[model samples]
Target: MTNQQLLTKPIGIDVNQVADSSSEEATKAESSKPELNSDEGLPLLLKAIIEGFVDGVLILTTNQEWFHANECGRRMCSQISQGKLPINSIPEPIWRVCQSLIDSREWFSDRKRFLEDEIKVNKSVEFRVRVRWLTLDLSRDPYLLVTLEDQHQSTKNSAITDVINYGLSQREQEVWLLKKANFTYEEIAHQLYISINTVKKHLKKIYAKQKQLMQH
Candidate 1:
């Protein structure tokens, strides 16, 4: 079956439908599985899901060569390179950051070193970029994953706005809101698209600010 067909297939059987059935009947029903072209279809399904992401997904080799790019990533590359896809075609600031990481060689050991910054896509547009090192098997060739989000978009919610009223910076507000939601520090970092160290920094600032307010 095609990727679309595989995606449209029911994910799991309904428990309610089997609630009234005999144990043997339910077992027989569970044994009946949908035909999936797993070997060939899985990659296509993954590609479709990655391409569907709003943030651009880009993969590059340690040497800075383009390895893969989703649809959104291609659009970002086009904006930066004017339809070209060469190594030098990437915006200078982004390339420099990537080069620095590659040069340090520390990322191989400290793979959690994720970088986040902004890059101007054009005279009127800019994008927030997040870069992370992906540790794959040495033989598979290591790659860096870059995700780009439009800077103009608002990631804030009402909870974040409430935190902002308490005199926190936007980043701090994000951290506070996630903390209020009971998200762990690592989960907050992942959800906010920031590094764990950055999350700690935000929390530190937030605590200091909150303590100062409490003293008043």
Candidate 2:
């Protein structure tokens, strides 16, 4: 969780190693309620990688109990819960998908299943939610992996895609993102740790690229 930590390490989960280490009975019992604490149950490296994800990642039991959630996941859960602090429970709208998935699993237990839903806050704001079963052991029940994506951030990403298509350089793309967010030149410079004149230079180049794209 610090800059001193390097993220270049390859991450992999050895399911065979984990499964071989535990007894069948233990795996079966633990599968009924797997440990959600990343510190105790998951590798520190895996936890760090999950935390670094832009989208929210949540793991929940079939009974809808809280298991583990990355930071973005918790934030989205709070937002869905209407700014409720200490999101120890799942939101009703999201839980509906889980409930549906669980009920459907009764009829099709052998197949991998996933469900999707969207939560609308208003006309302009919404979150895309997807839920699916995550199985660690063959003999155990699968936990639910719910991914939450913010539509607002998705819109920003789409805009960035357009900036890329317009042939903006990497620095120009960064400058354009801040500019699109309505940051002043001084603010953009401060945010990027660059001189104000450099910000203007980037903007000037960005505008030229946009103009050229329009002409084409």
lDDT of each: 0.63, 0.74
Residue ranges of candidate 1 with Cα displaced over 4 Å: 1-42, 82-89, 154-216
TM-score of 2: 0.60
Candidate 2 runs further than 4 Å off: 1-40, 167-216
Candidate 1: lDDT over CA atoms? 0.63
Clashing pairs in 1: none
How do the residues 142-179 of candidate 2 rate in per-residue lDDT, one tens digit apiece?
Answer: 77888899877887787688686888888888888877
lDDT of 1 at 84: 57
- Each candidate: RMSD to true structure? 15.6, 11.0
TM-score against truth, every candidate:
0.47, 0.60
